[model samples]
Target chain A: MTYVTDVPEMAVAPAGGPPGHGAVPAADTPTQWAAAYFDGYSTVGLLAVVGVLFLTVAFVGGRLLRPVVPTPEKLLTYECGVDPVGEGWAHTQVRYYVYAFLYVIFAVDSIFLFPWATVFAEPGFGGTTLVEMFVFLGFLTVGLLYAWKKGVLEWT
Target chain B: MNDTLEVALRLLAVFVIFLVLPLVIGQTEHKVMAHMQGRLGPMYAGGFHGWAQLVADGVKFAQKEDVVPANADRRVFQLAPAVALLPYLLVLVAIPIGPDNAVGEAIDAGIFFVLAVMGVGVLGSLMAGWASANKFSLLGGLRTAAQLLAYELPMLLTAASVAMAAGTVSLPGMLDAFEWWWVPWQIVGGVVFFVAGLAELQRPPFDAPVADSEIIFGAYTEYTGLRFALFLLAEYAGIVVLSGLTAVLFLGGWHGPFADELGWLWTLLKTLALAFVVIWLRATYPRLREDQLQKLAWTVLIPLALAQIALTGVVKVAIS
Candidate 1:
């Protein structure tokens, strides 16, 4: 092992070693651009750009040309504009929101759980995934238990 | 030239299904629901139960005045319709509408990819809801988010089980795996996925987003004219999308009972059958209470889904 060595620059290395093996040869700027841009064809990058251009035109064209006539009655808020009484929008109980938030966490947990179950049964994967799943379940259970203890699970 | 022409034709076919079919389904749904309820839905719009209803509706929507509230955010409000329409179109990118599940040779990962795309539609609704500046609209948006969170899991779990039993994720691969049918292996997931799909699409019993009695048309309270119409179209189209998704995900899409050939007719029949069920459910069931809905999803549906996942894993292991 060479413990103390200075790295050589690409300008200093000689080319071509074993045939059939890929060699780390110096790349030109334009060639690199061609490969990356064209999928090594003519201009693969142009397609993506063209797609974006088309999308932009569609969006802008629709927005610009869409017939819009601003009138008084048309501008009012919908649903007959019922006045929100009693502390208005902000005064509603937070319980529903909390339930939804907790449900989201648990639901997402279950989503991942399904895929984990599938991979868990394979030869090499079953054990690791099983352990991971149980641990993951532990956190979810804690959340469920927290909700249960708080009586958030019970509906009036 | 030939390849390009083929692609153009394929795209035209896709547009016909994606853009055009929703209008047909919308009309058919109205007629069927009307007949079911012992009423003539629309006999005047064109010929026989308003065959030309969609054309009239489209023109009316286009000509209607565009409305924007003084308090509403212009950018998000304007972006909402386009945003909502995009995801439906995007899912078409991965969806296998016809026999081959054709995305240049369907991959094994089609189900998961479509599921991911389905989640994005709610984002547009949320944007619409928030931008409207009305509390009702805001609440509607939140409900949409919550509704999706509730159902998306069961649907994913159901698909995962099907994938496990089929041992592949590709639509065609799943088809090949179970040349007979893909339904029996995932009946539990199918029921769950269907109900979850209803919630995902905001159908009855899960129509909290548009619970007209309580929230006054929910997320779209502020929209008018072409914008409102697009959202309306999106809703019905969304139902078609959901129906199609449920069919493909569970019922062995394009795989009819007859000898092993799947054509456009088979796809249309299967999708319509599922769409009929959606309309039937809407006709039959009352909307679910939000709390009850969340409870059902969390306590019952999710646990049941877990047991299913466990059962699937165990059964597969045993069989293997």
Candidate 2:
């Protein structure tokens, strides 16, 4: 499908091209301009389309090649060697959620660390950057210490 | 036209990663694991050393019965394996296989892109467990979600430290950052990445989710035929992707003797060596209990990773 035209007439004005020269007059229209903007992502879009197609083919091929054999016994939920009892859903521990919460805290901290790393290496920013990062860590350390003291770190 | 050709070539590389490497690496794991256990592996499958064992296994899996449990969520059960497998292929698109052999477009945030995409496979496992309508599968699925989430923190922290030290998160950019001196500074981060990566991959010592004896293959307990094959494929592919990531992040990716002429070979060598280490860990270590696994991640690895990041920051400040 020719979703975005490749012709230069369909092209929006270059970022700083001469005012009226080579700029499509229709580019002022939102739909056309939006399509042009989206043209940049066409490659990624194509990749996704291709990926979905590939998966479809694999699943279809498996369906074609594989046999379908079903019996009541064979279709029963597996409970090791025993007969299954009750519904599959069961209460999961609350601790998993706690761990997830702790992860979020650290995850945010790590994200902040990335930009800091980039800027910290710039000239004359070293000492102040180091001190600021330590202060940030001191707060994170306090949170961690609280988690530790609360026995949230214990896996039991 | 040029962009189309690049995307096509990248898709071809993705095909090779998904289709070809798994067979070779899976066979290597089989033979290696067999030897470690004091037996010959796949000695008779193909003339040499059962080198074609994976191909044979593929055919067998292709023809086996596709059985879904009576009580299972039929649609999700069927879709879970594909969900698991596809993300790894997408991840390959962002990974540079060699110095100049990046398959997809160079993403500026390549490392983060990889970590983000890789995490989606957990959804597939969770789906598999929930859809199977089996208690063990449910338990396994829950463990996968918990374990993966827990391990991902240290893994991301360690990778962030690498990105920090290298001053870029792009795979190719990090490769460019590698110099002799950067190695010493990254050792701690490198070790953390490898360990946490192993946990993320659910390889041994961290494989509680699929502990066969305890959980009957966990999330995969009810899978049969090609569906089961897809899960196994995802796993082996995950090993390759993680190893490649480890190589790119920590080792000087595609950098070796004569790397300028044929850097892809060095990248392959490093990836295979790391994969071997993963297999070695599988053979040597006993599986940690669920609590021990969490304890190690929360207490040991996370703190060490945080400290390593601080150290990386200090060192970068000191050097610059």
lDDT winner: 2
**Once superposed on the true structure, which residue ranges of model 2 sit more than 4 Å away at CA?**
A1-44, B100-103
Instruction: Considering the two chains of model 2, state its CAPRI-style docking category.
Output: acceptable
Off by over 4 Å in 1: A1-69, A79-104, A107-146, B98-108, B179-182, B258-260
Cα displacement (angstroms), candidate 2, residue B64, comes to: 1.1
Chain A superposition TM-score per model: 0.41, 0.68
Q: What is each predicted model's overall lDDT from 0 to 1?
A: 0.67, 0.79
Which has the greatest DockQ? 2
lDDT of 2 by residue, B178-258 (tens): 886666777777888888888877889899999998998899999998889989999999988888888888888788888
TM-score of 1: 0.80
Colliding pairs, model 2? none
